[model samples]
Target: MQKLLEGLIKFREIDFEEHKELFGQLSKEQNPHTLFIGCSDSRLIPNLITQTLPGELFVVRNIANIVPPYHESEEYLSTTSSIEYAVNVLEIENIVVCGHSNCGGCKSLYASDEVLNEIPHTKKWLELAYEAKTKVLAEVSVEEVDKREWMTEQVNIVEQLKNLLTYPFIREKVSQGTLTIGGWYYLIETGEVFIYNKENGLFELAN
Candidate 1:
């Protein structure tokens, strides 16, 4: 808590002081270009990883970067509201669902009942990636356990992208070419970002 307070003071004295005009302008309004749906991992900082400035990316983070398929009922309002506002009001041009290596949420999908029962809400939320887990397990060999988890994480990103399209408004914008959707995999150890290539159906280096 003390560290955070000190950082806040430093930010006001240095970072904020340097970007006074930018912060002032952003104080009034924010018009971000992209809606970045990433995992709630402490290591994976979206702004730091993307090198984006304030008011650049409107970020919505949750466990495993999961975006559940759009439901007509207003259930899960927290995630849904952000998606709706970003698309309808903010009119964000791009929606990027980013998954990372060594995601606890992805790993938890394979956890035993004993482990998951303690966190029932988390267990229920992770059900959104069941399709990803099932698909990856069927395709990836059991011998390659590490590879399976990596594949599952990447597969989850693709699954979430498909889920995002389930929203009528998002699909309409995408069809009109006004909005674009993408998936991303972040290698936590190496700090390298890989983007999904729809044509090749694989994640390739973003070079």
Candidate 2:
């Protein structure tokens, strides 16, 4: 409330003046460079982390940063629709799917059935993580619970990247070399970012 109002006042007084021309151009149209799909986590600020100015990255955020596989039904999914527009209309050259450390949504996927059942919608939504969990369980043995959660979070990024390709428009662009897809892991504590290399099937620090 009050703090947000004050922030707006400061933006009007200082920040707006600093970037007035950029804002004016943005008012006309936005030709963002990348489509950034990320989690709804407050700490995961895509623009701030990527050092992007206004109108640079078209963003679509959701719980767990999940991108559901393409469906033809009448259900209107805001995230998928936004991604479709970003790819088909805006023609963004790159799409980055970012997953972060200590993701509550991913952690909840492994919770007890009773706990998960309490949030029916969330549990249903998190079913997308099943493949990631299976992969993690097969590849990594977790002696501690926290490590298991973190591993699942990392694998979830890869899973979502695969799911992203399920869209026809995205697949077409990717095949034509007009679009690139990336999987990223952001570690909040270390302020480090790891990018998945399709060639290696591993996330290496972005250097």
Candidate 3:
């Protein structure tokens, strides 16, 4: 709490002051061009990773960076609602779903009933990544933990990219060539991000 308070003061006195003009303009309105869907991992900072300025990326973060397939109901869908607003309202040009190496959320898919029972909501939420889990397990051996870790992370990004198309508006925009969609696998330790190539079904280093 003390550190956060001091950081707030420093930001107001230094960072904010330095970006006064940018903030003042943003105070009027924001017209972010990209929608960034990522994980809630403390190690992955979206703004820092993208080198994007404030008011540039509309971020939606959650466990595993999952995107539940489009649905219609009288439900409070947090991530869904954010996607709706970012696309239908903001008219974002690009949607980037990023997954990272050694994702606990991905690993949680394999958690036993005893462990997941402690957090029922989280267990339910992780259902979205089951397809990715199934795919990775089919190809990787249990002994190859490292391969499974990265494969699950990358495959999960591809799954979410497919899920994004489940939204009708997004599908229409993509079909009409008005909107672009992509998946990214970020290596936290190496500071490298691999871009998912849909045509090749592989993650290529963004070099």
By TM-score, who's the top model here?
Answer: 3
Summarize candidate 1's per-residue lDDT along 1-207 as a digit string, tens digits.
999999999999999999999999999899999999999999999999999999999999999999978887745577888999999999999999999999999989888999999999999999999999999989877568799889999999999999998999999999999999999999999999999999999999888
Residue 56, model 3: Cα distance from true site in angstroms: 0.1
Ranked candidates (TM-score, high to low): 3, 1, 2
| Deviation of model 1 at 114, angstroms | 0.9
Tens-place lDDT per residue, model 2, 10-36, is 999998999999999999899998999
Score candidate 3 by lDDT: 0.94
Ranking by lDDT: 3, 1, 2
Model 3: how far is 129 from its true place, Å? 0.7
Candidate 3 residue-wise lDDT, 1-207, digit = tens = 999999999999999999999999999899999999999999999999999899999999999999999999798999999999999999999999999988999989888999999999999999889999899999988778888888888999999999999999999999999999999999998999999998999999997
Which stretches in model 2 have alpha-carbon errors above 4 Å? 141-143
Q: Between prediction 2 and prediction 3, which has the larger TM-score?
A: 3
Rate residue 177 of model 3 by lDDT. 95
